[model samples]
Target: MIDRVWTTNEKFKKRSEQNIVARSSLPWNHSCGSKSFAATMSTKAEIPHFVDFFKESHWSKKKDDWLDHKCMEKHVELENLRTMCSQPDAIPMSQEEMSISVLGKKSGYLRGYGVGRKPSNTNTTSRENDGEMIILREELSSLKELNETQQNQLVRQQQQLEAQNEQIAIQQRTLEKFQAALLRCRLLSSDQCGDDSLEGC
Candidate 1:
């Protein structure tokens, strides 16, 4: 929700600069300043972790941008964590708690930037990437379940068509039998009468 574009030269320049103004237009059932935010989340929640991450100084975008691309990506990841923590959806640890969490987790990246270093691999640094992958896999599994249900419905429809065709065949056979019986009755009456004309019999 915060829209302020951060800069490298002044990380945490002031409390105001560090603050990312949330999207203001959205109606807040829960205000950020209310005491109710504290009551909703667990003490061990990631809100604190997120707050800490931002406090560690944002990555500079210019002269000191020598950190690894993965680390930069990590920075973005940390920011996303912040958004998840302090945004309207992220309740309880609105300010301090959310900021601390992000800063704490990415402290290593900030240090590496100071010494002109980058993360060797961004994908495996923490369990965060793994967690995201797991979520995606779960979504795919749900989609697979939906597809299987559709296939079963299609099979049931085909079976119903087969059953209907069988019923039609039986009806045709019954009609033929009735017609044959009627023809035999007419022949017997005519033969028994021994009339010159079949119409008189």
Candidate 2:
């Protein structure tokens, strides 16, 4: 059974290799490459049209050189990509390392977006003003409470003064009544002494 399985695996590998070669030799692949070159040349030829549309002298030898330089750079990038794909294990990166690298890139982006800058003086001053406003509000609330208490005390004192004044008025009325009674008693005694002197005569 193991020998049969091994033969089957070899057959599958050979079939895959044949398929790859057949695909590479197809006329369509060559045609596609030729089409791509034609498209690139056409695009290059259209540069002058773009310059005319924009009303600019954008088509120059220097610009063409720059474009060629960009193409060479792109070719180098593609070659590097091919090399890396051919030997993926040559510089194997673990999942942890990939995550760390991604996190580092994200942190760098955030810093560039202004996360790394110190707070401005205006922000500091605004914070200080906020704190001062809170303190002032608390002081005002306390002052309101103290004023309420003082008002209540003044009302009580006013009530007490009114009560004392009423009591003094009542006492004055009682003293006047006592003085009138004493004067009437003295007048009655004098009349009785005059009657006794006439009887002795």
Q: Which regions of candidate 1 deviate over 4 angstroms?
A: 1-132, 193-201
lDDT of 1: 0.47
Tens-place lDDT digits, model 2, residues 26-129: 32222122233324334443422111211121123444532234334433443454455357233322222222333234453221111232323543464557
Residue 189, candidate 2: Cα error in Å is 1.9
Per-residue lDDT of model 1, residues 55-162, tens digit only? 233334454652345445545755676565455422223232232454343442332122222222332243346666567657766776887899999999999999
TM-score of each: 0.32, 0.35
How many angstroms is residue 39 displaced in model 1 relative to the true structure, after the best TM-score fit? 53
